[model samples]
Target chain A: MVSRAGVDEIRAILDGVRDPEMPALSITDLGIVREIRQEDDTVVVALTPTYSGCPATRVIQDDVVRALHENGIESVRVEVRLAPAWSTDWLTPRGRERLREFGIAPPSGIVDGPVVVSVACPRCGSFATRERSHFGSTPCKALYRCDVCLEPFEYVKPH
Target chain B: MRDSARIEYVLRFGDGALVLAQRLCAWVAHAPVMEEDVAVANVSLDLFGQARMWLSYAGELEGAGRDEDRLAFHRDAREFHNVLLVERPNGDFADTTVRGYFYDLWASLALSELAGSHDERIAAIAQKSRKENAYHLRRSQDWIVRLGDGTQESHARVTRAVDELWRYTGELFIGDDVDAVAVGDGFGFAPEALREPWLERVRATFAQATLDVPPDTWMQRGGKQGVHTEDLGYLLAEMQVLPRSMPEAVW
Candidate 1:
């Protein structure tokens, strides 16, 4: 029987697996790892994609499996679940900080609300920013320009 | 009857997403700007994802071998149940944005109600989809405001788009026998229940955009019954061409 401590150890291993698109942060940091359980000899990892059609979802699943296998765990199953949806609120504080360090602004405000919140410039840490476009390098990010720094950056969308 | 109603309800959701996604894809490399191109594509992908989920669930409810791809690629025009608003052509940027704005608002409202569905799977899918739909609504709303309140030419174009597409919007909230049954089964809401909220939101957005709401006139129908405008056939011919021509080829 896999102990609770074993599950923690496996989670620790997964913490090292970075998101393919944003390598500065791990999948755990992104909050896509829904649950980690040990059922008999199998380590079952339940995941939720950041977006329904995110092309990176398949890659993230593969990465989780690979990361577990590399840690000497041969019996692993990754299940993708779509419930309660994925909100940017799931992003860890560490993840948000890492995004800023990588010149990207983290999501701001509520996911389901219609409020228009200003995204601060990640580079200059200035509040003078405007959205250049509603899409960026990936589906989950939007392009913005900092009036203060005059530098363009990506803002991780709140959803 | 219950099972068929469930399938029909699911098809309504699936067809709307799939058809709109296909229309959005037609804008690839043809958008007014690079950023707009990417934005449209991402929205298209989001809708495509939702379509796959709904269609996959529809297939399961049918208990047949049909899957998302089969339902999408194999179905003829008469078999589709998407409202006519989605299958309409992507006329100009204004037309696309106006059509998208109308549909996205309706979809978001419907999905919000669906999230509370008694059917666990439907609720799960709705909960997942509503977030994306919210973002799509925001994007479309933003574009409508931009175009509607922009230069004279832009304002004129958007106004024309609005008037042209207004008639089709009525079909969104009109319930049919399938919708009635789905509502009875606790898996869906009455389409008419969403009309007021949809109208309120649209009115507010149009007010902000300085665009006039076209006066109500004779409304189009029959798309929900697998009847469509002439555009759908041409759209499907292009969309299904690759898949049909190379049935044996694996992509």
Candidate 2:
């Protein structure tokens, strides 16, 4: 039997596991880590994909395992859960700040219905931005150009 | 037989996604602009992911030990159950956009309802896909409006595409015994139900773009039942080459 403390420890280790694509953000901060549990002395971590066909998913899964092993935790299992789909609203406040520091605008705000958001420029904090493209370097982001600063940036889409 | 029907039903979703995903990848380096290239590729990636999920579930239901890759690469053209619309060739930019517009519009409607399906797995996949589908619809819808409302050349191209592709769309709304079985089991709904909403939205968008809506024509059928056009064979040949050549190869 595993104790509750063990589960929290696993969660803490996982919180340090960063996304391979956006290394500035942790998987937990990105809100893909759905659940952490301890069963029979094995730590199980559940993850949800931000987008269906993200190439980094497999890499992230491997990274999680490696990080735990390096931290002296053995018998780790990662499960992908799709029932409660991942959403940008789950990005932690600190995660949002990290995105800004990384030069990508966080999602505009908590949204409903449609995902049309007037993104503020991450670098200059200007609200005068126009969408350059509906897609960007990654599936989770869209290309936006700040009219004020004349700077092109990526915005995390509100999915 | 019920299990067989379920497998068949799920394969439709899988094969449609897989075939269209392949079709869209043709535009990766060839799209009109860099942003469009990335957008098309990103959309294809989403479809590929959805294809993997649907095919994985279909394999589990079949219980014949065939996984997603085996099912995708091993299947012959005659075995694919994707709609004729998806297998249709990606012609010009306008043709590809129009084709995607139709499918995305239908997917937007179908997936929203499927998200509430009685089957938990179906609901989960539908819910996840629905989110992506929304963005896809918005992109295609915006392009349709832009092209149809833009220069005379652009308007003519998209109009011709709509005319060419309209016949293939009727097959999406036709339901059969497999759909009946899925509906009876409470995990599926008739596609015919979405047709009106699809048309309403299409007409509204076409109006905004100043494009004339074409009159309904005799619709194409048979893709859902594994009877595909000549296009699917060539598509399968190109997609299945590596796997067909080396049965045991793995990445």
Candidate 3:
């Protein structure tokens, strides 16, 4: 399946590969696509996991390869990188908007130390929200409830 | 430098993570509250991920054909090198919380040191795991304080859990030849060195919780040498059943 394609074209195709856990965001939008390059006849895509134990990692890898293959270029390698580890800071502006539109609060504020975020309600845009649970349905999310709107939602935890 | 010692040292940490991860998984649908169920499982998942990385590296260091899957699913209880602390049963909410609190306190420091390891791969794994472990440490600490200071019943239960679990804490910092080679060779943390700092935090947390630190007693040891309690035997039986029975089974 080893073939060749322009790096930019390959990147665009990758943007269509949605994260299985968060269907609203692409790998690129999540900033897990660290690099895309060609080496010897294989297109290498460097990926970093948002959480070390994220179950979506394997599915996301398969999706990346399948999406690239569907576009005609074949040989693809999904290299997992752990260093300079993935951060909430890497989430793109568009990804943040997409997360809010999907009723999930995106990570906000500084990432250097402890995350003391004041998460606004994605639905009512109210700041009267409180964390219900530090862990949610997924490893990267925390459950929150908007007091004003009385709606429970997921907040992308700042890591 | 003989790779054997390094491999064994790595297995000690990996096996602890794996065994503890398995123990936490047992709490999935059984935790008292829905939020706790999710919380425990999340921590379990993180440890599982760390176990995979550590075991995969150990396999590579072994220069064997085995990998993370082979090492994890195939090993018997006698072959595991985890300390005794992690294999303790999830007795109650207090028991589980105390067990995790002890480990998190030590892991936060051990991982911080490992993050600077000369072995780059080990360093990377530690660097990545430490960030996640920090949150775990905070949560467990909070639970300890809340339960210890909450009510007469809650305080009594948590105090009893602490007293029962305290003896297991000694094995974490006590080391042998495997540690010597790992630390002497500059690839591992000095286990003995972590005790004071670990205790300092433990004392501070206990003070806030209004719980007394248990007096030292004869410590239980030997899990690192592959001599585990009966609990590990049952744990491995359940964990390895699928892999041992259907080696070729795929999801």
**TM-scores of the models, in the order given:** 0.94, 0.98, 0.97
DockQ of each: 0.74, 0.87, 0.81
lDDT of each: 0.91, 0.92, 0.91
For B129-245, candidate 1 gives per-residue lDDT tens digits of 888888789899999999988999999999999999999999998998998887888999999999999999989999999999877789999899999999999988888888788
Flag clash pairs in model 3.
A1-A75
Any runs in candidate 3 off by more than 4 Å, and if so which? A1-5
Query: What does the lDDT read for residue B213 in candidate 3?
Result: 92
Candidates 2 and 3 compared: the better one by lDDT is 2
* Cα shift from native, residue B159, model 2 (Å): 0.9
lDDT of 2 by residue, A13-71 (tens): 88888988899999989999987777776778889989989999999999999989999
Worst 10 residues of 2 chain B by lDDT: B110-119
Candidate topping DockQ? 2
User: Which sections of candidate 2 miss by over 4 Å?
Assistant: A113-116
Residue by residue across B1-251, what tens digits does model 2's lDDT show?
Answer: 89999889889998999999999999999999999999999999999999999999999999999999999999998899999999999999999999999999999888888898888898999999999988899999999999999999999999999999999999989999999998899989898898899999999999999999899789999999999999999999999999999998988
- Docking quality of model 3: it rates as high
lDDT of 3: 0.91
